[model samples]
Target: MLSIEGLRVEVEGKEILKGLDLEVNAGEVHAIMGPNGSGKSTLAHVLAGREGYQISGGKLRYLGLDLQELEIEERAHAGIFLAMQYPVELPGVNNMIFLREALNAIRRARGEPEIDALGFMKQVRDKARELNLDEKLLKRSVNAGFSGGEKKRNEVLQMAMLAPKLAILDETDSGLDIDALRIVADGVNLLRSPERALILVTHYQRLLDYIQPDRVHVLAAGRIVRSGGRELALELEEKGYGWLSEEAAA
Candidate 1:
């Protein structure tokens, strides 16, 4: 569903992603594990079409279309969702209204009718419950007063509601405790389908234990230096990323 080849990205004249390459097909879950400053989040943001990052080299295609050509909203309408590492707070904006408008906009772009208020509320409530997110938070501003775990669950809630074709989750497990992690993972697992794909950018292997990835990649020095199966995550957990960095340097 997504193709990235030799992708080099720079922020403010400094390169973050250097010659990174990855391919994620439908029905596949890929985990990207790396230490600090390895450009994991850069890849996720670039895939989501976030601006300010100069694409210095290579191509990124989604569903056979050049992703760089699409605007951020266009990317979202095209079924690309990025659950950010830190979900921003939009004070004074009702969470439910924001979600409904966003979902309706995507639906409208797809030539589908907008969901009615009742339907939207029901769907949001159901999804919130599934994610173990407090229904009351929907009435508040988006992530305004939410705890770290709450914010992460809110991100997953958005993912569940949008039903994107390719979901890029950047550190969804970063601040979550075991309980919150399981709830978020279950929500993610529920969205898994033969036609959907997920790219999880994480620092720890614990997240992979809940949502088993088809492939695990060690990204160091801005490129994927090693790719393997679930066992790769286990090995990383046991050995850490030092070995991978040394190997990549060698």
Candidate 2:
């Protein structure tokens, strides 16, 4: 579903991604594990085509199209959904309004008719209930005055509604307690299907316990140095990144 080769990116005149290569197939869940400053988030940002990150060299393709040629919203409309580590709060923009507009925007881009307000609300409300989100939460402005857990749950809610082909989650488990984590995980699991893929970037193995990614990757010094199965996450958690980085250097 996604292919990246020699993906090098620089930010603020400093190189972050040296030469990262990764591929995520359809119906697969890939986890990227790295310590701080390993460029995990950088890869996510570049993939989504965020502004200001210079692509010094590399090729990224999604569904066989050159991803570098697409705009941020274009990438999103093409089924790339990024659940940010920090959910931005949009004051004065009601959550339901934001969701409807987003859904309609994607629909318009696809040349499909926009869903009526009633239908969109029903879909959002049903998914929110299944995700165990409070209906009131959906009525509030996007991430406005929300707790950490609330923000994360909101991100998952958007994902559930959007149903992107490739969902990139950057540290979705960063601030959640066990209960909130499970709530978020349940939403993610519900969204999993044979047609879509998930890329989970995390530092710990606990989230992997519930999700059980098909593949795990260790990124160091702005590149993916090691790739393995589920056990790799366990090994990294037990031994720490130093061991993995040394192994990569060797």
Judge candidate 1 against the unseen true structure and give its global Cα lDDT, from 0 to 1.
Answer: 0.95
What TM-score should be assigned to candidate 1? 0.99
Best model per lDDT: 1
Mind giving the per-residue lDDT tens digits that candidate 1 earns over 1-250? 7888999999999998899989999999999999999999999999988889999999898999999999999999999999999999999999999999999999999999999999999999999998889999999999998999999999999999999999999999998889989999999999999999999999999999899999999999999999999999999999999989999989
- Per-residue CA lDDT of model 2 for 45-87, tens digit only, reads 8888899999999889999999999999998889999999998
Model 2, stretches more than 4 Å misplaced?
Answer: none
Candidate 2 local Cα displacement, residue 27, angstroms: 0.4
Report the error of model 1 at residue 88, Å. Answer: 0.2
For candidate 2, what is the TM-score? 0.98
lDDT of each: 0.95, 0.92
